[model samples]
Target: MAQPRKPASRGSRRGRKPTSCTQCHLRKQKCDRNQPCNRCLQRGVAHLCGDSINSNGGFKHSQSPQVVSIAPPSPSPRPRRVTQPPMSPSLGTLFANRGARAFYGSSYFGHQVASRILSEEGQDLPAGISRGRDTLQSFRDESSSFAQVWDLLGLLPRQKSTVDRLVNIFLAEVNWSLDAVHEATFRSSYDEFWGRRFGFDDLANVDLRWLGLLFIILAFGVLLDSPPHPTLDVQREREEASLRFYWAARRAIVIAPSFYGESTDIVRAGLLVTRYLLYTRRVSESWLTIGFASRMAQAQGMHVDGERWRMTRKATEQRRRLWSHIYTIDRMISLALGRPYAINNQFCLTHEPENVWLDDMDDEEANRAVPQPLSLPTPSVLSSLLYRLAQVVGKIQEKCFGMERASYEAVLQLDANLVRWSEQLPPYFRLDNPDTAADDALPFLPWHRLYLHTSFHFARIVLHRPFLLRESITDRFRTSHEACMSSALADLKIRLRTMNSTNADSLRWAFGAHNLFNSAMILGIIAVKNPHSAQAGAILEDLEAYCENLHQDPWLNEFGMAELKVVELCISKAKDSRYTSMTAYPSGTPPEPPGPRIQAVDGSGRMRPSDLESPAMSSDMSSIYWPTVWEDGQFTFPGAADFSTWEQMITGIAEDNYGGQ
Candidate 1:
């Protein structure tokens, strides 16, 4: 082998002429000595092309185009050694490059996750096509006339009574969950904003961040204040009005160019926008917005504990509250999409917010404020509790979905950790225990408790979902199956009860819809696979109730209908023997359908006999009579359900796109 070339000495290169442009010189590539060199053009950095570095290692700029003499190659020089092809940049690099413009669909997880889980049982349903286009079109139509000049205050409700009602509704019914805006701060600012409403020196003097946040709050008020069991026309009116305010918030951001700023209100507005998008089933858009909000929060150093900077106690508390909520929402969107979370817990030094009531908090007098304990029932405990759970969820995402197949040991460990997290919950927040501290409780507490448990159970389902297959239902993995099933059942039952309760309006949010959809899917699979089992029968009943409740929800859109079809399809499969025989394959012969592909990371490989074995995984599965598709003691279950195809079929019917296929 030829020895590596020796380093050139300083004296040897002192008189040597430059051979490349600055861009090429830095990359150490052979460049043709043109104004914009061949290497610079090839590397897509032609704009950065300049004179090569001097012997002193300083780069020189050629003000005008250069005409340098090209050096001739020496006769019979040794050829350069061949090198390996360049590797593609990692995901971190792609995301971190601020100059790069990526155009992947914003909604990464909502439908993709549903498609994956539904695909694994036996069929590939059509992936839910995004509704982002129609949403954008509506936005453009609504904002077009006002694009040049929006009277920011003109977007507000004309009547003071209406404004007061909306503001009061938001502070009372909605603020508990978000805790993004401080009530005291907002009230003071609201008075100041109206007092100077007409005194702005043009729109530039307006507080765009505050204006955006106000619009978002008003949007939430319109959205959440709907009467129970609203009619389609009423729902349409409410949605339009809500969108109007939401759009105004977006326009405020555009005017302020808030993406370039680090204002907390802008971040707050972005978070609220994310939640609103989810409510409209614009899941991809929500994902994109939340990601941008996460970056904005990081830019403000919100991920770091504020106390370290010697900020006022109230400011520190506010930062903690905002950061925790951001982290919570980030994990939620990530988990729902089956994607990696934005904020890593290891690097996040901010602690959970104290359970201090908004009334007790005073930015100027934090010394007098007394925070409620974790065991006490307080509105401030909501985000703090959610952050604790999000930490566990972050671990679950890494251990299970992070690998092709999580180790059985890893699954059990994560499940234990999750159970411990649930066990440590205060009695007021616990599902099994009743809230005795109702003396100072908010009306939303009951709904809040259910919401937290819904998330907790959802995490359990995701963690144990891989080991939930019937083939993997041995004694060692039996707990995993039970945990998954129980969590799904519990989730559906809770949703059903909530729907029937007097507080039925509380279940109108997107998180509830997403969780309910996921649980229904899991139960649907159980019903199909074990059609004759009493457990399957119970699951079917709950699934039907869920469907009925879903129909009553004003937020139901195409995606909602798609979810309905998913459960309906599962029900149809269990009840119709003809469909079953037509769809099902013989034992050992799994069919290859041209549908949405199943993810290998979903624990498909781990179910095989060769991949996992335990003393409990004996030949005798006599008690359970769900028809076996395994052949020769190998996992070979056919993919009988095509969720993407089925969804496409349903959507085609709805849109009349199939031409009577």
Candidate 2:
């Protein structure tokens, strides 16, 4: 009792306001019981009222505390108060400063200093400005400043040094927007300064070798942008410069040996010489140059003797390699210009009728047909040139034949035999296929045969007078003829086996029928000229039978039909017309009549013969017949008939004008 000692009266107990049960028990804080206590409610924390303080420490209200106030605590010291500095002005703004900007824009030292500062700060600038800096640096490194000289003489620097410095400057400015400046400077100083210094009388007389060296240095100077520079004109200038240097070096080699003792340079010069000569119309000269270059390369151990320059092993392989690259480049140029490359000797043989046909034969016949020394013409200049050309082309073709080496030889033999075949056919054996027998045989025989004949004819023409065929001429004809023949044979075979099925019909539809007639015409030409030995004739007859069974096919379009008509006409003329009554025409003439003339207007508005000419008309009936009749109604024996018609035919066909016609 004395126990609680009357737990000192509430206010007097601690000498402070009495604590609320909520504060003392739940929150453990002193509470006055004011409307909102500073400790809890002011902090937005909820306040709970304890049972109203029991007067005697006995219950005066519910056991659990009652709510007095409701509030939340202030958030913890706002996350450490971070701070950041303001953003700096962009490059544009800095450049926009009136006083400094004008100085930066000026061409004087102020601008240079500003550029240096900006560059140090890693800022971007116009390419021209950057290029100017590069050029200045290169010049500084290559030439001593005028300030370094003890005397200020009025005389100019030596020509060689001046030229070197100018070239160096040009090279330095290559990457800059200084192209205009470089060009202007180059043009102005080239003749009066550099040209005179180098002992050149004029731009044309400038040592091509020196020019080439300069250009090579320039070419290797600047780095190229992959997508290319934004300015195509600049790119083009660079390329042209490189090519000029290359050509100059090449010309120097063609003219004379390198002045310097660098064998590599000499090799490069020779390669270029060959390339330049090949690109020109001087085919003979080009070949000679190439030969000389090859020899030089070999002598210098740049190339192996047996390998030419193409496949070689040597310490100076790079120099040897240049020859191969030059050869290839020149060849391409020749093709583009429709000029003949020295290596294109196999020209008409691969594409001409005679050669192509011969190429399509069995190896035995091809091997047997190789012209012996007796058969081949002796090596005169023209013959020598032809032989060289042929040898080169033959080598190329042999390589192309790859695994099927025999194929090329086969084709060549077929071509060679064509002329002989043409000479053996009888005059009375018309090409008409009464039983359509020739139709079956025609596609296979006539095209192959004609291909050979035409090829030989072209070769003779080129030998007598060289002319450039268009780049795609041979390829176009070869592809078209091959397609036509392939389709026809497939159809003929299908027709022979399956007479009425829809599949057979479809195949026949796809395979042209006119091919049969075309093939037969070709065969007839070959047969009529050579009454093939019985064995050959039998083979041809069998081939003919195999070809005629295809249905009325449609692949033979109007143009193809026209060609077939021409073939038929030629076969008929050969067999029926007693004109020359010759078994075979001379080397270059065809057996057909020339058709019509095509013309074009010249610049002066006058009519002139067009690039192409029409086929020639047949000789007048009287002219053709009277002589034969007078001589005897019987056909002239082989080599006995007047050859005028044959000559005219050959001339007409061989004329460039008659090409397509």
Candidate 3:
């Protein structure tokens, strides 16, 4: 029978938001109200809301219905049973039981049994399989116990530990690959992958300025920690490898189209790579690295010309003073390498203006002034490059032969050449401009300083040689010394005058002061050897006064102070030492002296020597005095001196003992 409808109460008739289902509301308890209220629907209970069945057995209806009524039907119930299909085994169970048992269970059996079965079933199984099976069986027999197998499994190392152990191996592999790439690209070595592909061409296409600096650093690093190669050929091969890697990394930096901040990583990597190349003696490649970097800077809106590949006037002129310094470094390197002056050989500077006047040119003028075919300049950066190269070469020579006669001679030759070349540089070459004022004259002190230091060191080597007096080399050395000193002094005077000028705050002026003082010290040392040379003494006094002035000044650098002290020590030694001269013998006379004669014994048992007298000498003896054997007509100063005393003086100066920190 269907259920009858229930009548709604007056309160229920009012409109309100439904909080719960009608069945739950009627039950008056919390309900989830999923499909039906649990209490009402689960119990199959249908109760009226505060109402009873009508007398006519008909559903009662109210103004608003609380619930719908249903008619009750006669019960004729019969339940039916349903059968379900079987489920298949899961993948995990299948793999664990069937697959594992098949593979591992047979292996646990003796290899004899397994091999016999394999032989019967297989047509041509690999011979190694029997060995593998035997090993597996042995392992299984050994670890038969559950606890043993469990412990063995637990004893295995973790993934993290394994990864840590392989980290160095991975890094070494990467380095090797990068080096191979580098060799193929820049060193003209045949690295199959790098050579066939044009991977490094992009890197080569980058600006040269950046590449030059980077290459130097790289070559320097390699040279410092030379590769473990038996021969020069192998070493060169490895170096070329390093170069290719550097180029690739640089190429990556250039092509990376991203924000400046994002590109820093690439730039930093390129810098590090280039530094390594430079440390390796791959100087040519290093220059290329610098070129690339300069291009990159230009590409980033730095105004660099691609054809004559150099930074624009506006960009470089701001740092124009650095040009001399850059030029000096390049020159030094070329000299050290014993290569002909090829400015564009390793690095390109076609974009740099020929004249300083171009720096101030207007746009229209600059456009017209730009040369049709940019000619490469001479090796202008030789000085600074030579300075750095000397340091590197000195280290190399020291390792090969410490204070060897041959090494010293070679050093002297280089020094002599440097001085000669520097002197030969025309005044116009030194002068940045025709109208450059006396105060603004290009400082020659740096050139003089470099010359004097190199020369003095060369002189020390000469004086230290045991056979210098016997050898004809001394004459050649003396001549070179005079030439170097005279020219150095002339340049020194100009530098000193410039330093004393009012515009001393200028970078050139400051450098002039430093170079002047430094050159004076070197000259002072040279003078000590030639104390009789009036010019030498005058220069020494001038140097001393300069040092004193520096001590008074409050702005000298620590390095400058140290150098000054070295000069002072050289001067003090020169003043205190006694000068001696080597005597020249007549060309035809026998070089050997007369032998000493033995006298007859006077005693009977033991032989006793009697005083021997020479044959009667002439009453009138002519005494002949010759000029002292001055090195090139200059006195020789003792090469050995405690340079530490000078070091201390400089230290005191640096520490502000003179209130000039």
Candidate 4:
């Protein structure tokens, strides 16, 4: 065996100097060595342009890039013991360079993350795919990124029946919740593809971006199969195939730069992709993806009024619809992550979408419809309702989750505003007025009801979640806490029942598995905190049903079933205690209230459990043995704040590609 070579000393004299940036020099390429240097600017890692102590063991230029390394790069390209490849930079070392070392100075740290990623990927980069090359160019080959997606998912079957069936499934299952693309447009595209191609060889008829969108739609059709067909092996196979296509679509989009263009296709795909990422519980990645879609919308001026751009009436409506979806996604993700909204309201002036869905418009007449006066506004009741929710979500983030802590009075005012919002909603959309719902709107009534209710309850959760950290609830804050519990119970009750019901349907809906997941968690904690309550049995049942609904989803399988089992077991123990008491003292008499007296950590006095066996009812807890909301069995379920590390890395590429906010 050979010994490792000693690193060269900085004072050592070296050979002839190289004329390249540190990145270029490290990769053995020519460098323009401009301010950001050609390679750094090309890779959009311009901020990472500083020269390291170059291989010559001396400063190459006075205008050296400010980047610092853990230590100098190995003097020679290959270490003395060439049998094994050297390790790329360690995570701790990269973080240190970015944080304490302040690698980028005043520039955003997003690029630092990308540079480190390319550094780590250095060992495997192909000869033509240089590290400092354009970021998009480097990602042109995504086979590794989407290894599971290489196989065709049969999204475009030759049989018209099969294509129709899958299309129906997507439309029937998730369309209401996502309403991502116009159904008419989607079917037309599907028809065009199936009519022409039985394989990839004839796929030229479909645009790469649209093909990607089609794959996602098919994947969602399989992934969103609720109350799945119990006896069908084919359904299972399709699901497996759908996931492969979904990931392949993900990979394909990254490979096709045109997919990111500021057009409806990219915006639709981005929104749906973000939604799919979130549903699969890829919460952090969803946040990152939504940022891309949001920027794309901004680039297309979707954030501004159509009149300002001189767009046609139909074009304006399409822009509004796209903007609405992006805005909702933005709010949902920001709230889910407890982060600030990426779209600054000060810069946004796009009007809310009108009552007309694109499906209702005739393409020929759509142009003529643009001249209608804005004063006679009739909103897309469902879309507009969701848009309002997004607005509230934005404020909730700012007033509640932002740098400032809202006062008791401020919280109360916001609560009142939420209530007022529901009151002002169109009568038919209100939960209380289903009997008066329009005949044509009946198809979507249940969805709207649930959506309206979920928004109210979820908002309540955000508003009072802070109370859990408080040592005590004061008189002013007492109502707010009560409201939180009340809304949570209400949110769970309707959501669980509607989702489980045979008749439930929505034409264009918001709120589903994602909402239910959170709802189950809130209810579980409430049941655990007050375990002896009469409602405990129902709470456990709700959790059981939620688990069933989510079990079919591969990405959610681990957290979904595992979290349910934990909640069920805890509640079961309490139920057993209750049964024992009832057996001791028969029916007519009051048996001893069941379960431990463990009050959950509600941010007030109940920080820790009252005693050991009982713990805080938190889905986000670090462990199942302790108190956890939803944890991976492998002990790696990303906590709400735990995703912070990935947040930077995930969004890093967006900064490089989209050129930052």
Candidate 5:
């Protein structure tokens, strides 16, 4: 069976190497080397077999190996399969741009997009790198671990009574605005959750989104119940506990793997997170998070009327409530920051939530259950009313503040719409009703009433703020001026009431702070421009009270100081004005007093760009009328014509210095 091996031919001898070819040497296998080695030919790397390609038998620095040799195939040769190197699998083409990646430090490639491309391309990533599917699978696996779930639950106060109290606080004080969680449904789930935690059921079956909802509730309770001015140690303890609960909530949401989640619970959790972010003064982050939650809700077709999809009655009502809440928050946050909102009402088909109690929705005969008339107040009446008002606010944002200068006709129309909304309110909820004390018996009604009035007044301010300047002042514009001032003063009274109420702790939040700050700014502007007006004393008193209130709230300290400085600056300017004794202008336009005197052909007291040729800017900085401090910390009067610039300066200070916090 065995014959002596034939002597190598001259060409075969020339082809055979003394050592292994580069491919075989690098692979550490025996090589029957020729121009193309036997191993290379078998592995389909015959074109890569050359000893001179790499002297030390290591790989070249090139991204891909060089093809050094290829032999013509024989007739009827066996099919060859291409094999990749064991050490480095082929990555093929990257989805990300190399230049952009280098410039932007790798984050230029979004995780979701990159993961999708890599998965499609069948690409290999380096060790420990996580792809999207890998991340989701890990989350699912971790969620199955009872120990991990238990560890998260263990971070909370263990007493059932304590937990109940916390949940009750959130439900009573905060949930009225959000209505993200239904009390009955949440209570039922919470009971089952604790049962599972205590081993009555499987922990693996627990819903992380609902668990996160509970954690968010606890965080709110801890934050809302903390004393106004706690001891440093106590404050620190409270902060740590609140943050612990908040982060646990966030972790639980991530474990729910809510990135692609479209469930009501996940969307509700996201909504609550936005609210929490807003309360904590992370405004921009809240805006971004709300957008994410909006997308999730939209993915579930929550933006469209659920009836069109023929969903269950209960599901329809829930989607409606949640969508209204989402839209409201989106408009509020976006309008507050002068950013565009996520939902355009024109494209949305979801109906407003019916004025029905949450309990009524759970009725077995829900289809037969009738919604309460708007004439009667229900538990959800506040939410229903707010939803309606938010619609008006959204319109105002679009018609009035949406452009550089809205037409007077559009302003009147939006103002009328606001008036109609107010007039339609029930007598019990009417801001103009003398009996503010009547609603105290109803839980959260007093608070809701205050909120409703403050929002209405704030809307009035926003609707008319553009024309508040002296340059824009005229008899026709007189209506806007009065509206701006009256609303500002009305909002101030409400603020004082809130500070004195038992609900003060719950009301000490940034949502109302923005309203208060805007009101204070408007009042300050009026007081400086019209120092001799009869209402000046009252305005200053209110502003002083506001500053005091701001000083008391730890969250509002910086804003409070900034407001104080502005108020003080206005008062000083008023006292120094030569027209202190002059009565307010009958036409509602205040006289512009002489300041850093730079004469011009137009003695209209309005400064022009050419007026800057004078040495006023370089002159002594001490004497000017209501001098404005710019971003660079330098004071400039600029002129009466530049009053809008002053407003911008103040707003800029607030946005730049305090908005992020």
Candidate 6:
């Protein structure tokens, strides 16, 4: 239920009010006042049965602080067991202070912590009282109530231990987008927030903004929980839990308009909404959400350098960091969809963040000084580095692949620039280099390094593959196909190393899968063309190993495996052709290759085509085969799949027969 926007106040009672159980009894009416009596119970309300402790018949006037009631057990009862009703509103009058809920015990009302956090028992807000909503929300010194700070614990797992475990799992597994939510505030609230109740959040102290942000973080945590629960079971349970918190946070945003205000609180929560969409396979939805967040961020003047606005040191750095993340998100989704960038570099003038160690910033809302460089890179430093790298990636995607097509020379230059970018990364950022940082074998080194290398290879493929197919046209149109193939082959080698190590689990998820899947078809084609090469053999081996993990996700896995199989089949045919040529040429020398051989095979994969369905001429006569599979993962035309179909497709030499064909 949405919270009422109005504050508690003594307003005119212009509408119908209910008569209490005691009212009918005093009037000597046979009211049948069981709990509410027949009169009040007919309205489906659990009417308070106690005598009026106050002139207002148990309910406090809008002028006073409202608290929950503690109704006593009824004297007469003979029926199936039921959950007891809420305390009578009159009972609350005995308590001198409004903070009465703190005095109650769990057993006193047979209530559980889950009930306190998850279930909405005593609180009820009027829905759609359109005319009265404004009257109630009118100005007051303080309108804050339990509704503004409700415990959404019911939205989490029923087991407290399970919730804690998932929290750990979430933090560990989630690819922290923009590294949202400072670790300190989130942990601080988490420690004391659980011991709190609806009206008694001791730690939060009525900071509804922080509480709302906590829920968003927990939602992401739930979604990223993996491994511990096994595969499918964990996925199902975590999804349910994530969705629960996702709604809770989403509801908080809509109810409290303050969340969207110019506070650091909104920065993390706002971006997570888009992050959540992407994590859940809602790609299209994520794009819209990210775009919305970018607009909100720009509205807050985040596009300008924080220092220029004279903001706090921490606030300035945070804005720059967040905007960088937004830009990265725009690049990732835009590249995926082939859409124009939302964060155009031409307009955004915000200074990029510097390499400040994250550990130093852990408790740094107070420290006004700029952070200094660490002996080696930290997560914070890595984040800034990645942001800058993603900027380059976005620029390349937009300029080279979008509206402007780079010439062969420009492509070569860009490739060299990527190499230089990798070379320039700080010592710790380059995982392969034998630096002092690796003397002890960094804990998360392999996981991060694999991602870095994979992304590098992906950029190379994206930059170079368009020209690989055009290489056969003419020297002018041709580009270095070997460079493209070599880059792809290098990616396969790195993938093999990753899957063989402990980091393989994380590799199968999120952008990890995206980076790897983009090159599957390209590698398959390379393997087919050079099936006997040792390099090709290793790649095909690792490709099979990688596809095994993808089996858990059917959509991408099936398509990926299908394309791999096409390459495998093509390689097999190539090997058979080589064997046939070897026996025909005995002197260890082979005859000059013929221009193009054609064959015809029918429905049984490699047979003859039906008489009525006479084969037609193929578009690419220069192509060695009658038909071919293009680099875009599509077959050229009908009968393009089986090479044998080309023989029967040929035209006769005679003029009449040639015309007929």
Among these predictions, the greatest lDDT belongs to: 1
In the range 133-171, model 4's lDDT, one tens digit per residue, is 243333333543322223333335656675566668778
lDDT of 2 by residue, 193-261 (tens): 352422211122233333443433333332121122225565556445444544445444444332211
Summarize candidate 3's per-residue lDDT along 463-529 as a digit string, tens digits.
Answer: 2321121113224335445544654565455545554322112222332212312356547545554
Write the residue-wise lDDT of candidate 1 on 126-168 in tens digits: 2221122222232234454222234676788888778778888
lDDT (Cα, tens digit) per residue for candidate 5, span 129-167 = 333433334434655333556678678796888888878
- Whole-model Cα lDDT per candidate? 0.61, 0.32, 0.35, 0.55, 0.61, 0.50
Query: In model 4, where is the ten-residue run with the lowest total lDDT?
Result: 652-661
Name the lDDT of candidate 2.
0.32
Can you give the lDDT of residue 404 in candidate 4? Answer: 46
RMSD (CA, angstroms), candidate 6: 16.5
Kindly give the number of clashing pairs for every candidate: 18, 48, 71, 15, 0, 19
Identify the runs in model 2 with alpha carbons over 4 angstroms from their true place: 1-251, 254-258, 277-285, 305-320, 326-651, 654-661
Worst 10 residues of 2 by lDDT: 462-471
What is the TM-score of each predicted model, taking all chains together?
0.64, 0.23, 0.33, 0.60, 0.64, 0.58
After superposition on all CA atoms, how large is the RMSD of candidate 4? 16.9
Cα-based lDDT at residue 532, candidate 3: 42
lDDT of 5: 0.61
Give the runs in model 3 whose Cα sits over 4 Å from its true position: 1-305, 308-327, 330-352, 356-365, 370-474, 500-506, 512-517, 578-642, 645-661
